[model samples]
Target: MNYMDMYKRWLNFDEDTKNELLNLDEKEIKERFYKELEFGTGGLRGIIGAGTNRMNVYTVRKVTQGLANYIKNKGIENASVAIAYDSRKFSDRFAKEAALVLNANGIKTYMYKELRPTPMLSFAVRYLKTTAGIVITASHNPKEYNGYKVYWSDGGQITEEHAEGILKEISKVDYDDILTMDFEKAVDLGLFNYIDDEVETAYINLVKGLTVNKDIVEKAKNDLKIIYTPLHGTGNKPVRRVLEEIGYKNVYIVKEQENPDPNFSTVKYPNPEEHEVFKRAIEMAKELEADLIIGTDPDCDRVGVVVKNKEGEYIVLTGNQTGALLTHYILENLKTTGRMPKNPVVIKTIVTTEMARRIAKSYEVEVIDVLTGFKYIGEKIKEFEEKQSKDFVFGFEESYGYLSGTFVRDKDGVIASMLICEMAAFYKLKGMTLYEGLISLYEKYGYFKEDLKSITLEGIEGSQRIKEIMDMLRNNPPKEIAEIKVREVKDYLKGINDLPKSNVIQLVLDDDSIITARPSGTEPKIKFYFAARGKSYKDTEERLEKIKMEFLRLTI
Candidate 1:
């Protein structure tokens, strides 16, 4: 059926919903119903709107109902689910609505009484031994967006096979048949439980275990001046409490963004990737002469940092740079203390810089590349646990997400915040800055800079345009980008590199630079990733600028 037919079906809805659909334009309707909410490697994320395809009450109900059916089919007599939400506009309501649907289907449910981080939801699923979990957040997406992510019993997002099963069940549900029992009734019948302080204590204890160098934190406790901002989301309480428990004496929270505000009043785009989001925090840091500034996205999964360079200017570190620095710090510290794991492994996304791989190799640690999403990294962690062949050391992605101790199944900003502060304090003891530490790593591992460019294609035609761009690149792979000879191509969708095929096509240049292109599975955009290396920092910057200009010229 056409989008108009779908829109017409909504005429039976109450006047409020029916009138809302009738007021939408053709483009709006098409955008809303262009495709189903797909279970990507990262789970479901989309702009909230009125359609079966968009994130709405009906979509949420279908997803929850599907999850309930999937859990029941697994032969678990009393299947349970945990649900949490962030501070987005409709996140809390959506989460409760999902819980209601699950309760109606005879599934036990545990939901947070208030907003919480994505990682906390992952931890809750395991702590409660629930059959599954749901987090109502879009991570760092704009205010207009929201999402629903599903996690399995192990606390990691559902694997591809399980996701397919859930999708099948979702398809079988008729929108009108999704029933919701009263919240009071569900609770009275013992089908619902609100997570409380006891669960919070368990989570905090797990986070505390992530601190490897407590002695260093003890030494720098009174001296290290650190600034942190939760960006008006769920990280505020946990992050602050963890830092305090670790003995950090002078931690400054950004006052304007300290509270949970759904609007994210302090910035235009709440994403930490943009330097502008840190303008106020940097100003505060400068005045206090703080060692570092940290900000986490709404759901507190991805983290961003700003540090003083050698020239005394505050600079925001790219996700790759931050990950590389953190990786180097953790591995070297473990080795120095003679505590390095014998069978250590470092996990990263396929698009992340190979420089981290090189650093890990130098430390005699294995580097494993997985598909995009931290869930793939979590899957690898599970693989290691079952096989006992390798120990999971660290995991990260290019999009400002990292995991260090595996206490949580997802990327954790709270732990990342604690580790980043410790790293800064470690550098301070050497009379250096985090910026200087990063530079030293570049000098040791060969200078490298990475860049990511995301081109948004909105509405129905936008997706087709993104596909056209990807197809164009695959058919006519760049022979040379900025006069550098193309040495190899890696197609991830085909699951081949020089060895296998993948949807991603990476072009290796004669000068050892690399450019890769792939369509984002969770959003309507194509991302281009570029990495260039040089003998020194100055040389690296020069080459990076040249390659960036060439890439822009070609793509834009």
Candidate 2:
């Protein structure tokens, strides 16, 4: 059916959805009905409403039924899927709906008893040996957005191969063909079941085991004062449990933002990458004189840190800073203690800071760069497990996602929180703060600064405009950026370095600076990533500013 056909068809859906559609103006109607909510590589994500282009029961069911078909075709008898949800609007409803649809298609589902983090879903998939997994969340997007992410049995987000195959099946599914059954019936038929604490316990235990400086955690227990905020999402219980159990008693929660609130009432955007989201936490950090503050996003997959600088002002650290800090802590401790795994390797995305590569090389640990998603990192981990060529120690993306252990392939904000707290404690015992620890890393690994700028272009015309912008850059590769000569330009879409083909470009500058342009995998935006280094912070930042100014001038 075309847009009108789908619109008319959806008009007769549930009364609540129909009412939502009836209230929309002409433009809103077109925007919501312009096309089917795209089931891209990640899965469904969009504004919630009643339209072909919106997230609703009909669309969710259609996608679930398609997943059911793909799983059934895998020839695995009695294959099941693990399901989890975050604290998002309709997250529970979409999760239950997906479960029942899968049940109706003869595939069993093991769903979390309550809302959980995305990494928990990834862990559940592998722990339960399910055929696939699904998590209903939009990560750190604004409250109006919700999403569904699919994971293969590998405990990682689906890669391009699985995405392409599953999307083909999703496209073939029709509304009439999308099967769903009663929740009670599904449960009675042994198709719907709640996940037990077995998986949860195992997950928390794994996160706790990733702690490197165990003795330091105990020593700093009395000294380090930490404040945490869940940002009205799902990181509350596990993050606190990990910290408390690992030997920290001074952990404080930002009560105002502690609960699971879909509205994310306090923050305009629920993303931890943004400094604004740390406003409340910063206030609490100042009041309590906290050693550091940590905030995780809605799904609890990404974490941001705020620390008191030498000037005594709380500032949020960039994802790159946090990532590099964690990398150094992990490797330095391992090397000093002689516990470093043989042939240990660290992985980072192409757009991540070059400092990670440099730090890993300093430790004699191999560093490999993949395309821009953690799924690719997870893929490398899987490859290592099979080939036994190298041991995967850590992987991270510049967008505040990090993973240490192989228990969960996706980023675990809970683990990150625990490890970050441990790192802080380790530094405090050495009589330094996390910010000071960050500076120390800079000194050892050279001064580095990174920034990201995103241009959001929503709606139909905005989508077209994004394509034009990418086309402009691709067709006419800039010879220079921000007055610096472009030493080399790498276009990944043409398939570079044997990595998966993606619509991304990276410009390496003559002065050892780096810039990358890539559309967000989960949002309708184009992002530019800049990384710079110099003898001092001011020099690097000045060069960074010039590059940013010129890049924007060329692209925008």
Candidate 3:
């Protein structure tokens, strides 16, 4: 339907929706109704409001109906969908609305009674033996945004084929055809059931079992001062619980950011990937002389780390740095314990630092590079489990997401947080900090530095400009960047290296520096990733600055 028709329909629906629509300015109306909210590779994520292009009860029901149809068509005899939501605005309502839609379509639904993280939803799907899972979250998006993510029975986000099938069903759905049962009626009829606490207990126990050095944690429990902040999201309870259960007694939670606040009042951005988000935690860490600091985003799937350097100043470790450190720590521990698998495998995204490859090779373990999303990493784990070909050791991306154990298929901040603490304790017992451990790695693996630059372009015209930039770069590929010779260009759209097709271009430079340009699948922006290697930290920093400037000039 057109914007006018949609607006007219809204006017007759309810008093509050009508009032919201009536108060919108012309530009706001156009932006809200120009297009339907898309179900991207991850799922539907958009601004939360009263419009076809936003996230609301109506949109949630429509997508759930599509998912219901797809699940029925798959011929699962008695299909069920597990549901969970984070602490975002309208998250609880949207979760219930989606469950009711599924229930109305004759599917069983299991939903969480309270806010939970994304990884827990993945675990729930597998634990409940449900056919699929749905999570209401916008991840680290701003307060105005919300989202819905779908996962399959294997405890991973839906793959490309499954996404296409669901999108086809969604295309056929109309507003009037979206079916939903009353929430109370669905529960009375046994079509909807709340998730029990046992599931959570089981999940926590699974995460706690992943500790590589329980002895080390117990030894440093009292002396290893640590600071953590959930950034007003779902990580507070679970992260702290796992750490405390594993014997970390001196954990300090950032008081202001502990509780769930939709506005995320303390920071400009809720994403832990940004160092600015750690402003409050840094202050607390300094006063406590904490050995380490950790923060997780809204959904608790990604985690960021901060540690004191030799100069006595706390420094935020880039995702790559933390990832590399974790990789080496896990592998080295497994080797020492004589538990390293015969064919151990480590996984990372293509854009992540190549230093992972070097670190994995030092242990004689294989490193596999996949596409950017954590779903691809989870998919690889599923494949390995099925084929029994390679043993999955560790997986991570450059976005502060990491996975160490197979208990949860997705990137898990719960487990990552626990392991980060244990890893810190292990080094602290040796009289060194995580920053020092990272410096030692750099000394061994040639100082490698990486930077990400994202250019945001909103609205219709802005999207077109982003496309123009991508097309220009593709058609007239540069032979050199910042006076460095381009060794090769890998266009993922054409299916390079036996990977799935995607709209990504990666340039390999002669000096082993790599640059990748890919549009954000979840947001309205295009990100450029620059990686540079040098003999010293100063040399790498200079090269990174030169490359970043060149990329910015081209984009402008």
Candidate 4:
């Protein structure tokens, strides 16, 4: 439908929506009504407001109705779906609306009684044996945005085939035909159920069981001083509970960011990957002389860390550094404790640091590289379980998302927080900081550093520009980058490699450097991932900078 037709539909909406539409300027109205909000490979995400292109009650119900229809068509014996939400604006309402739409379709729905992390929702789907799951979260997007995530029966986000099916169903759903029932009526009719303490306890127990060496946490729990900040989202309760339950006593919470604040008042963005997001936690860490500082994003699916270096200054560890540290720690500990599996395997994204592959290789474990998203990692876990081909040990991306156990199919920050602290504690017991441990890994594994650059191009013109850039790179491939020899080019779009098709291109340099470029699936941006190996830190940094500059020049 054109913007005018969509605007007429909005005019007939409730009074509040009508007022919101009437107050918007021409530019604002056009941005919100020009197109329907995108339901990409992940799910629907947009600024939360009134319009066809925004995340609102109408869009939420419309998507849910389509999901309901897809579920019914599958012909599951008992059609049920699990639902959870974060602390984003209208997340709870959206979760409820989705549940009501499912209930109105005579499908059973279970929703959290309170805000929960995205990984927990992934777990709840398997725990409850629901046919599918939905998590109302935008996942570190700006506060103005919200999203809907759809999961399949295996507890992973919907794959491409399922997404295509749902999208087809959504295209056929008219706004007027979307159905919903009153929350109370749905509850009384036994179609809607609220879940709380029971699921939380089960999830916590599974997280605790993932610990490789419980004795280290028990011994260092009291001496390890750690500061944590949830960034005013869903991590507040469950993260704290897991730490305390594991016998950590000196843990301190950043008071200002402990509660659920939809606005994320203190930080410009709720993303943990940004060092600025940990400003308050860093301050607290300095005051307490804390051993480590950790921060989780809004949905608690991604975590970032700050640890004291040999120079006595706290430094934020990049996602690659943390991933390497934890991977080495887990594998080494399992080997030492005689718990190492026969066919252990680690998974990483194509864009993640190649250091993970090196670390896994040192231990004789296989490393599998999947596409960008963590759901691909989860899908691998499911494949492992079904085939018994390999044992899933650790999986991580350079984007600060990590998963250790198979209990949750998504990247889990709550359990990751526990494991990261536990790794810190183990190293502290050895009279070395995490920084020192990282340096040792470099000495052993060779110095490997990575850099990621995201160029945001918004609006219609911006999107066109992004496409132009991708096209230029794909059509006129660079034979060499930064004067380095290009050994091979793996264009994912062409299915050159034995991987699923995606709009990604990877250039492998003869000197062992790699450059990957792909448009962001969930946002209006394109990301470039660069990796370099050098004899020293300075050499690696210099090479990374030169390559980054050259890539930028090409894009321009």
* Tens-digit lDDT string for candidate 4 (1-556): 7887788789898999998889888888788888888775699988889998889999999998989898888887889999999999999999999999999999999999999999999999999999999999999999999999999989999998899889888988998899899888998999999886888899999998998798898889999999999999999899999999988999999999999999999999999889898888888988999999999999999999999998888999999999999999999999999999989999999999888888889899999999999989999999999999899999999999999999899999998999999999999999989999999999999899998999888878878988887887788878888999889888899875477899998888989899899999888898999999999989998998898899778667
- The positional error of residue 64 in candidate 4, measured at the CA in angstroms, is 0.5
By summed lDDT, the worst window of 10 consecutive residues in model 1 runs over 494-503
> Residue-wise lDDT of candidate 3 within 1-556, one digit each (tens)?
7887777787787888889999988888888888888886699999889888889888888888999999989889889999999989999999999999999999999998899999999999999999999999999999999999999999999999999999999989988899887888998999999999999999999999999877788899889998999999999999988888887789999999999998989988899988899988999988888999999999999999999999999999999999999999999899998889989999999999999999999999999999999999999999999999999999999999999888688999999999999999989998999999999999997799999998888888888988988887788778888998889988899998788999999889999899899988888889999999998999999999998898678666
Q: Give the TM-score of candidate 1.
A: 0.97
Q: Give each model's whole-structure lDDT.
A: 0.86, 0.89, 0.91, 0.92
How large an RMSD does model 1 have? 1.7
In candidate 4, stretches whose alpha carbon ends up further than 4 angstroms from where it belongs are none
Worst 10 residues of 4 by lDDT: 490-499
For model 3, give the 10-residue run with minimal summed lDDT: 547-556
Total clashes for model 4: 0
User: What tens-digit string does per-residue lDDT give for candidate 2 at 435-530?
Assistant: 999888888878889999999998888889888888887888889876678898888999998998999988899998988889877788989999
